[model samples]
Target: MIAVDQHPLGRRGTVVANNAGLVVMVKELADGDRAVSLTNETGSTATISTTADALGIANRGPYRLKDPWTKVPSTNTTGTISASVPSHATVVHRTAPGPAPLPP
Candidate 1:
């Protein structure tokens, strides 16, 4: 679970993709630190706005917001998110079949 702090700009909110490919954002943030977003899938952008939060998500309470949508998980997915700058992007290796047994 991720936590978000309320921005100084009157607790505005924005949906953003985290390193784990989750869609999350802060909703109805308080005057101080608070959480406001959550993601449900990969390869999707988090919607950030000053409006009445996102369509599917709603402010559950005075200092919290939640997504009313359900999420489904996938099997063929594995990756990591990083804010650190790298020299270049490269493929470390490719998938391969297991080795076959030798003759007896």
Candidate 2:
């Protein structure tokens, strides 16, 4: 909670999706990046999704996602930002436009 609030990308949030047990919020950063929040309000796990257009991000290239809480890295190349969130849990990600690095 503190880490998310204190992170620079975690400000200026705008709710993009809120329904079906999934709530999503987006924050545009100054460095051409985005902070996206996926919250699951259901008793069971849920899959939440949003688009780059919905996130107000103009660029359409591949994007990289890093979890502020977990420090886990992922990628999105489908213009869609989706996540499988645990019940009543919130997953926050930092999205930046770029290609994912090759895995060795």
Candidate 3:
């Protein structure tokens, strides 16, 4: 997890890549208090208010030619979310295969 306080305009947070080769970023708003924008490798972005209980996500993609997707918290005003490539996008879902099983 990463944290920022009073970030500067156009200031983007660190980029973290998981084993799946997806790049993740957190951009803080210079004007708003504790407001941040989270962007995935596909350029999808989500803006959330740290103070208030609000969250929004906009899916932007060149990977998958599909409608954008958005999600908001149901119960709590604020919550955490994890995003991966859209199903339509071509992604490797299975892990590397081990050596072929020996004949029974």
TM-score of each: 0.22, 0.78, 0.29
Tell me the whole-model lDDT of each prediction, alpha carbons only.
0.29, 0.78, 0.28
Task: Give one digit per residue, the lDDT tens place, for model 3 in 1-104.
Answer: 12233334656544333333343333334433222222324344322111122211222111111111222221222233233444223221101111233566
- Candidate 2, clashing residue pairs? none
Q: Each model's number of backbone clashes?
A: 12, 0, 0
Q: Candidate order by lDDT, highest to lowest?
A: 2, 1, 3
Task: Give the per-residue lDDT digits (tens) of candidate 1, residues 1-104.
Answer: 22223234464554543445443454343333333333334343433222122322223222222222221211111121112222221111111111223557
lDDT of 2 by residue, 1-104 (tens): 35556666556688888997789998777677778999999999988988877887645467778877676776655578888899999888888876434567
Query: lDDT of candidate 1 vs native?
Result: 0.29
Model 3 weakest lDDT span, ten residues long: 59-68
Model 3, TM vs. native: 0.29
Pick by TM-score: which candidate is best?
2
RMSD of each: 19.6, 5.8, 17.5
Candidate 3 stretches with Cα past 4 Å from truth are: 1-8, 32-78, 87-104
Provide the lDDT at 76 for model 3: 23
Best to worst by TM-score, what's the order? 2, 3, 1
Those runs of model 2 whose alpha carbons end farther than 4 Å from true positions after fitting are 1-4, 7-11, 70-72, 98-104
| Full-model lDDT, candidate 2 | 0.78
